[model samples]
Target: MSMGVGIGRREITGMVVGAVVLALLPMVVQDSYYRHLLIMVFIYGIVASSWDLSLGYAGIFNFGHMALFGIGLYTYGLATTLLGISPWIALLAGGVLAALAAALISLPILRLKGIYVVLVTFAFGQLVVQLIISQSDYTGGNQGLVRIPSFHIPGHNLMRDHKLGFYYIALILLCCSTVFLRLMVRSRLGLAIRALRDNEEYATSRGISISRQRLITMAGSAVFTGLAGAFYGAYFRNASTDVFGASLTTLLLSMVLLGGISTIYGSLLAALLLTIFSEMIAGLGAWRPIVIGVLIILVMLAYPGGLYGAIAAAARALRRLGRRQASP
Candidate 1:
């Protein structure tokens, strides 16, 4: 929209440089602690960016992201365990299952407005989690599944490989997901989804097919979130039902919110900043959440548009300064 927000050459260059630094981080920081943090940032960034697709662009404001994610992990866990399928194949299964579930629920659920939509989706999320816990036979219940298989890239078992390889896998996923999302939002479906968010009534009057578009975007959102969950499970070789709690959901949501909803770059920036901060504070042992929460609240208050929003604005300001200085 405005130059204040659109990514430009300088901004792109900065992002590329930042990504390069991250890719090389594992070489510099050999400690698993910091390497794990970087991996978390990359995985969580993908999740937050996916959440922004619906919450930010589609104005769906879904609080049920964790449900989609849970379904994904369970789907992968079950597939690999039961069918003897590879983790990579199971990962695809997870995404498809999540998409199907979202498509099934979107129409009736998305009909409501305001808090009702939030409430319904939230309830759905809670229900899914409980269902998983209850069906211990299929899902491993609340105790969760263990020894999950690692996702393989051809012959490469990412689980057993170099930390740098894992980082590259995650970074590739993030970059590809980001580009895919941008294209999806800019395509015909993207236009419909944005319209549905901005003005449902007018969009409907114009033959936008709100229900159809919502179903598609919801499925799309679930795919990304599900893939992230699959990656998370593979990285850790475990998936606990309880771990997919409201706090984790809130964490992803917070990243999207603090990053600037509807902006993937915002999601990336927020995830990196927030995750790194949280990990650092967590070294404080018992008082981590307090510190993390305070930092989040302070950032929220200080920059309402989230991390990337501020970065984008500052970049634009710098461009203007440069142009003025160059002019006679």
Candidate 2:
């Protein structure tokens, strides 16, 4: 109990210090380009962390998570640009819509096991992408939506002034997502999800409702992913079918696996690092994807538990070494 309390206090302290540093980053960095990259990092981090909630924690193996995100992008984009709705309200609406979609999708596939669930979800995502492409008149089709409005304070354009406002907004979203997911992983629901993941039959025998747990997790994951999508549309001022593509799904999965499955903050950190790395290699042109693929393969082979797991292992080793030295 004391050890757990000590660890909890350390985590709290780390989070507080990290939050303070992030809050002051804009003031210290002063580079609009870097700020933009950091904003992308935060956006992807939110999406990745939310994805981890279902995939890692609950073992849902959802491959269409990006589709939920795409739904939010289109929902918010269309609501604001076509229907003249407030962006803030549209953001909330997008999340609700995505959550509803997730619940609906999970309903039929609740009984599916393993790869079947993955395939169905992947097909669902493809279906969404195709629908977006087919409905060019409304969705902007292949050309994509353009001239979407940015977040603003009436007279002040947030995007016009160095993107600082968007940065802060993304920061707040990331922080909220991190805290929410952290709490979720420690909650009773999370415990039940883990139980189901580890032994579905045992969990079900113990009176844990499999469908109920999955539906809840699916909906919860979609909510944050949708919000991230809404933010993406606002930040980039565009919506494209690419948001629902397999590439992004793969990238996000890589982030989660590379960071450490079931570790929310680790996934967030991986998103940040990977986003920055991708930016750095952008000049490599066509070779970028190959390089990233190789790097991911190497990391997976070397550190199966991912960067976070490797770091934890190293810390444990160092502590052990220190203990031995003290005994001598």
Candidate 3:
């Protein structure tokens, strides 16, 4: 029940400081292009972090995670355009629908392990793509859905702000998702999943219900992922089958792995870093992907723990140096 697993004074302080800096970032960086990229970071941050809950913490090999996002995107698009619902409600509907899909998928994989889980999840993702395409009457198939409604403030214009409103909204979404994921990972639920991941037989021996925990893990991870997808649809005012493509799955998987596993903050950091870094190397043309791939391999080889591990290692070294200086 305790949701304060690894959080401490330093972590709390870091959260506060990081929030302040990001909140003030728009003022310092006035470029709309960069603002757009930051918004993407926020979106991917939510996604990669939520993924950490299942893939990293719970040890679930859910290759269909992006499907949840796609479901949200299409859900929001259809809800607003077809069902005549408010964009805001449709946004939440995306999450709910994706979570339901996750639960449904979990039922079959309850007893499966390893690559079997991966195969089922990956197939599920492809199945979703096929379904969307087959339902072209509503989904727009390969053409995608266009003219999706955007969010509205009471008296303000969201469109005229040069993406300022969207940026803040994305940031808020990332913040909420991070808080929710952190709480989930720090709660008893988190402990149970970690146990399951480490040793399923041992965990079940300890009276933990594998089916229940896995079910919750899958559903919990899908919530924010679907929300991000919904926001993606709303922000761009479009929904496409491309959302379920392998390219995006690879990108998000990179963020999760490069950020470090089992640490919620790691995925968020990786999302921020990778997005900015990819943009920075955009001028590399075809070499961009090659360069990025090489960089990921090198970093993983050097520090298997990823950026979080590197940061933690550096922090420990600095503390050791400080202690040495203070010692007689």
Candidate 4:
């Protein structure tokens, strides 16, 4: 059976090649600052791709996706700072808690659609922020949690290596996430998700349980998103309510759009592109955001399919030219 474009051989080969290059990056680019940015790119890539799973595939306007990330972040923060647990254990705990939160939120939004889904999810995020603030002594409220634990090695110190350990960890996490999302989207469940997204009524008539699928869709998407969140906290050694803010939400949303909806890998590409691009224009200071916003708008207007679409178009054009040349 044929799968989606995201699962094609060409795309898979590209992913593999890209992964190899990224794996070799640390050796070539030893600068800690650049490595820091790449780690962030990996983290954002995981979050954005997970968001794509729900928003792009299932067509769920889950505005609280970042909320799930925050849950993981706080879970790690509190676990390490309060409970005195290992950072490794706290990381997994974070993902688990986020997944649970996603499942719970899915129940309420199951019957809702479109903008209502957006509203409910967005409200859920705000509710989480308020809860964290109300529990200031534990969460540090507005000040957030600081001096959170970082990952430890048996012999070597993590900090001494210029973030090499964290970079590899982030890369591995992103790779796992990308593989998971792609597999899910190419599976029977993924087909049902797309079907439901296109026509809920028709999908239901075919015996696809809207509730079950929707629940899985929401929960599955949250897993890596939560992990990424936990990683963010661990990497930064802190947790902040600021994660639930609109800025991150907007940036990730732009990634999903700029990458091309329904293509899991596209979001990752967008993450890499946007994160680096945003940093490159940092000298613009006040104008940096304006430049990015304008670029995104122009790109979207010119190519509705985002980067993936533009690439596909260029590929098609090259093939056409090749064929013409061969015919002569």
Task: For candidate 3, write residues 1-328 as lDDT tens digits.
Answer: 4554665678678888888899999999889898999999999999999999989999999999999999999999999999989999999999999999999999999989999999999999999999999999998989999999988889889988888999999988887888788878878899999999999889999999999999999999999999999999999999998878766687788899988899888898899889998889889887877887778778889989877788889999999999999996
lDDT value, candidate 2, whole model: 0.88
Write the candidate numbers in order of decreasing lDDT.
4, 3, 2, 1
> Candidate 1, TM-score vs. the true structure?
0.84
Q: Model 1 off-target regions past 4 Å?
A: 1-31, 152-160, 284-286, 301-303, 308-328
Q: How many backbone clashes does candidate 4 have?
A: 0
Clashing pairs in 3: none
Worst ten in a row by lDDT for model 3? 1-10
Give the higher-lDDT candidate: 2 or 3.
Answer: 3
lDDT of 1: 0.79
Q: Give the TM-scores of the predictions, in the order they appear.
A: 0.84, 0.92, 0.91, 0.91
Q: Which of the two candidates, 1 or 3, achieves a greater TM-score against the reference? A: 3
Per-residue accuracy of model 2 over 226-324 as CA lDDT, tens digit each: 988998999889999878764566678889988898989889889989999989989998687788888888888999988888898999999999999
Cα lDDT listed for each candidate: 0.79, 0.88, 0.90, 0.91
lDDT of 4 by residue, 1-328 (tens): 3454447787689779988999999999899999999998999999999999999999999999999999999999999999999999998998899999999999999989889999999999999999999999899989999999988889988899999999998999998888889888988889999999999889999999999998998999999899999999989998898788866777788899889899887898899899998888889886876787778789889998888889999999999999999998
The C-alpha RMSD of each candidate to the native structure, in angstroms, is 4.6, 3.0, 2.6, 2.9
